[model samples]
Target: MSGTFSALNAATTALWAQRRALDVAGQNIANVNTEGYSRQRADMQAIGGSAVPAFYSTSDGIGGGVSVEQVTRIRDAFLEGRGHTEHANYARLSTEAGALEQVETAFREPGDQGIQSLLADVWDGWEAVTNGPDTDATRAQVLQQMEALVGGLHFASASLKAQWNQTRENLTVLVDDVNAAAASIADLNQAIQRGNQTSLPVNSLVDQRDLLVMKLADQAGASVRHGKDGMVDVIVGGVTLVGGTSATKLAVAGSLDLAGTGTSPVRVVTAVGGHTVRPDGTAAGQLAAMNGIFPSYQSDLDALAKDFADAVNGVHTTGAYDKLGNPGIDVFESADGSPINASNIRVAFDDPALIAASGLPGAANTDSSKADEIAQLRSKAGGPDATYRRLVVQLGVEAAVANRGVQIQQVITTQIDASRESVAGVNLDEEMTNMLSYQHAYAAAGRLVSTIDEMLDVLINRTGRVGL
Candidate 1:
């Protein structure tokens, strides 16, 4: 009788275990399409023999049954880490490539509307003056073309400055995003810690935290580390942004003044400790462009403007005279004698009669030597045009390199993500198969329980019916 009862109990336990496994499989199937969800499995363990007195012992020993041990989520920590690193690299390169492409558009190289074309037109106007220097018409054309050249330079400089300003605005927004993500991660950390303390399954909370950390990494090049009790720490530039349930905000500091001539290095600092963060993600790319690439281009443009002005003024001031018979005043001068640059360059002479078209003051109306000299500057080897071409080439090369980096990192990131998904992501087909398997086992266990009950019924009701 005892053995029969034990068999019934064991069959009941097996049924419960199989049902729980089926429940786990159903859960996996239901969340198959859920993002960041890791598939869970029910762990089963065989129950050993129960203690019994020697008088009650029957056969050798009867095992209790199977019982559920625990449910666990499948995940690969190493693959997840690699995926995060590759995502950061991809974001950085893509950001830089995008910014450079914008700058290249602003330049408008090899087009009639660009500075290179305008400079060529200015030289052609000077050549026209050499053809008929005494004519007001020729001098007027030269003045018009020079004005266009100055305007073109100013436009290019303004465009670059505008890009810089936009980048600063983007950085501010990204800082806010980073802070928000960090705070959310910290909150999730607290929840996970509490769940862990109670021995509750916190897989969903962990997934949410990991997603937030990945977002933070892309936004600010942040790094992550896990701690005991299911806590996570997020770091940016070696400074902790989140530790356990506490998060530190980020702030952007620096002048976004584009009107200034010098470079203003932007800094990202933690709100609590004021430690600077040299970001690694998209923000890092934008900051590099704003402080390094764009500024270098602007400086080059300024130098070209100054050199071009000096070269033209050097010849004009020594050669011809204005209508008042005075030595030609500087052809290009700032309101102050400060060095000429793209932003402040302008046509110095407002009147066409002020143009110097000859080498001798008395020959200003007829001699074309000075105008010829100025026009010949177009062919100078190290002139403004050549310098500008070099700038364009450099920009193209940098943009290409950034684009290549984006491509390579994207491939690497994709591969790593696939690997992670293989380990953690739910597969509907696999879950369905597991579901069928658990269902069959449950049916078998139920049948065993029914059979054991019938045997007990026979022992209790039929064995004692001698007359029947």
Candidate 2:
């Protein structure tokens, strides 16, 4: 009887263990297409025989059947950490490349509609005026060309300012997103830690938390440190953005306007402490574009405008005369006499007769030397045209470098993701195979239980009623 009961007990445990394994396999199959889901495994261990010897207990060499020890999530911590780093790097380069492309579009270089071509038209107009000093049509054409050049500069400056303001606004929105994600992660941490304390299944909670953390990495190059009770701390620029169940919000502080960037600059800081976070992902890319990339180009454009006005004015105001023979004043000036820049540069007057087309005193209609000198300024080494060309070349090189960086990093990120998927991602075929194995085990255990019942029936009713 004892032997039969023991066999029945072993069969029962086997059935339960196999059932648990089948449930785990089913779970894996169910979530095969789910993102961020790690494959799970059920660990089985054979129940051992009694260790102590007792007078009432018989010595049985056979051990009890299997029991499930625990279910485990299949994840490689090292791979996950590397994944975070690579993802952050990829996001940074991608953001920078996108920003550079926008800047290039604003310049519109290497095309007929760009500032370079407009500048050439202005120079050509001056040469035309020099050739026909007394022709009112040629003088009017020069004024029109000058106006076109100023318009180009103004448009370029406005585009840059618009891009700067838009990027700043995007940074603010991104910080808000980061704060929301952090708070959600903190909430997840609390749930996960509590589940861990109670020995409850918290794999789903962990998966959610990991997804949020990866998002933070993309947004701010955040890193993670494992904490007790299955909790993780999120770090950005050496500061803890989230610890245990508490999250720290981030804020952007700096120039609201592009013109004020030189004085105020842009920075990401903790909302409470105002401590700066020098991030490296998308946020860092935006900061670079706002504080360095756009501003550098804008500054160069302004300098070109000022240099252009100064060079032409220098020639027009000295040793030159207009049709009326009055000394030539500045040909370009701001509305209120403010320092000239790309945004404020304009033609000083609209009258064609006011144009200084001659170099000799009181001989404006005869000598064309002043107009010729201003036209020749286009070929000067340190002139506006040369400066603009350099600026365009620099932008092209930087943009190319940024794009190439994105391509290279993309390859690396893909490789790492593949490696991670191999370990954590679900495999339907494998799960199906496991399901078959568990099914057979369960069937065999059921058969053993039936066999045990037959033996018990023979030992009890048949053995006692043989004579009847």
TM-score, one value per model: 0.92, 0.96
How big is the positional error of residue 40 in model 1, measured in Å on the Cα after superposition? Answer: 1.9
Q: Please, what is the whole-model Cα lDDT of each candidate in the order they appear?
A: 0.84, 0.91
The alpha-carbon deviation from the true structure for residue 455 of candidate 2, after best TM-score superposition, in angstroms, is: 2.6
- Supply every candidate's count of residue pairs whose N, Cα or C atoms clash at under 3 angstroms: 0, 0
| lDDT score for candidate 2 against the true structure | 0.91
Compared with the true structure, model 1 gives a TM-score of: 0.92
Model 2, 112-200: lDDT tens digits are 87999999999999999988998889899999999999999999999999999999999999999999999999999999999989989
Candidate with the greatest TM-score versus the true structure: 2
Score candidate 2 by TM-score against the native: 0.96
Model 1 poorest ten-residue lDDT run: 255-264
User: What is the C-alpha lDDT profile of model 1 across 93-201, one tens digit per residue?
Assistant: 8888888887787777768988889989999999998998878898899899998988888888899989989988999999998888888998999999999999998
